[model samples]
Target: MKILDANDKELMTVRKIERDGNTLVIRGKIFGAMPMVARLTPKEARAALKLLDFKTFFFLLTLLFRKG
Candidate 1:
């Protein structure tokens, strides 16, 4: 997955996502910067999903629908 700014410039790349036991591992990079990874347990991931702002979610939905 690719993250873009409002102008549609690529900001980050989501390289990989994998499950390790009860946790989810996310690996990605910040544009022009070092790579980063994060691990979140199922509970934490669910909470984070709930915290997504409406505009961001709408932007993502637009991207999806446009592609389809």
Candidate 2:
């Protein structure tokens, strides 16, 4: 998955996601340069989850299974 900045420019390309204990590890790159990792604590994870409500969750599911 690719992350875009506020200006819609490429910020980072997520390479992998892993769970470490109570943290969610996101491995990615910035500007296609050095590797970067984001460790989201449980609190932060919950905050992020709030951004993906039920309707959005189902939308993502549909997109995932949609045929071109």
Candidate 3:
């Protein structure tokens, strides 16, 4: 998954996603910035999903629609 700014400039990229026991590990790098990795439990992931802003959701939806 790619994270973009309002101008559609790449801000970050989700390079890898994996399951670690009951947790989800995400690896990525911010464009022109340092790398980052995060581990989230199922509950944390759910909570993060619930916190997604409308614009981000719309961006993702648009990307999906474009692929189809």
Candidate 4:
């Protein structure tokens, strides 16, 4: 999904996610040019989870495990 700023400007688009050990690796692009990789530690992941609702959280889990 595409992440946008307050003015609807494109930020970075998340392409895929993978879990490596205790961190969540996010692979995507920045401004649709430079490749970007972000690793979320367990503590950071928990902090981000706080912004998501119960339904959204479950939905994401399903998507993560869904067969392509």
Candidate 5:
């Protein structure tokens, strides 16, 4: 799955989208080999990055668990 920006630019390739508490967590492979951290917004997830840790968690999981 792919995430596109407002202009339709590819932001990240997603593996899964999960909800944690009042936040939405996105798990995916990013920038080739880097672990990316991005948190979901309370209202609009795409608006800001409030929680960085959640993003890191998802990133690691996707990196380690993604099947070849």
Candidate 6:
């Protein structure tokens, strides 16, 4: 998996992805954040994983924000 900065600069990467039960997980580190675990349920994690691309994700957010 690839992690990047706001400017789209490559920060770090993981050789593999891992999952356990309902949780999706990743390893490695970013510029400032620690080597940490973000646990999300199968459904929640799946929805989130679908938004890995920033462009589409932000577009959704912008649409929501505009509506709100």
Best by TM-score: 2
Off by over 4 Å in 4: 47-68
Give the runs in model 2 whose Cα sits over 4 Å from its true position: 4-9
TM-scores for all candidates? 0.62, 0.68, 0.61, 0.65, 0.45, 0.44
C-alpha lDDT of candidate 5 relative to the true structure: 0.70
Expressed as tens digits, the lDDT of each residue in 1-68 for candidate 6 is: 67777998867765446787667676666654556555567788678768679887778778756842
Point out where model 3 deviates above 4 Å: 49-68
The residue-by-residue lDDT of candidate 4 on 1-66, one tens digit each, is: 888889988899999999999998999998889999999999987899899999998899899778
Which 10-residue span in candidate 5 carries the lowest summed lDDT?
A: 43-52
Better of 2 and 5 by TM-score: 2
Go through the candidates in order and give the C-alpha RMSD of each one to the true structure.
3.6, 2.6, 3.9, 4.7, 12.4, 9.0
- Model 5, runs deviating above 4 Å: 4-11, 43-68
Q: Model 3 — TM-score against the truth?
A: 0.61
**lDDT by residue for model 3 (39-64), tens:** 99988878988988999878878885
Tens-digit lDDT string for candidate 1 (30-57): 8838798989998897897798899987
Q: If both were scored by TM-score, which would come out higher, candidate 1 or candidate 5?
A: 1
Candidate achieving higher TM-score, 4 or 5: 4
Model 1 spans > 4 angstroms off: 52-68
The lowest-lDDT stretch of 10 consecutive residues in candidate 4 is 59-68
* Candidates 3 and 6 compared by lDDT, better number: 3
TM-score of 4: 0.65
The sequence of per-residue lDDT tens digits that candidate 5 reaches over residues 8-68 is 7777788778887888787786744555656676777543444557878678678867774
Better of 4 and 6 by lDDT: 4
| lDDT computed for candidate 6 | 0.68
Q: Rate residue 48 of model 5 by lDDT.
A: 42
Clashing pairs in 2: none
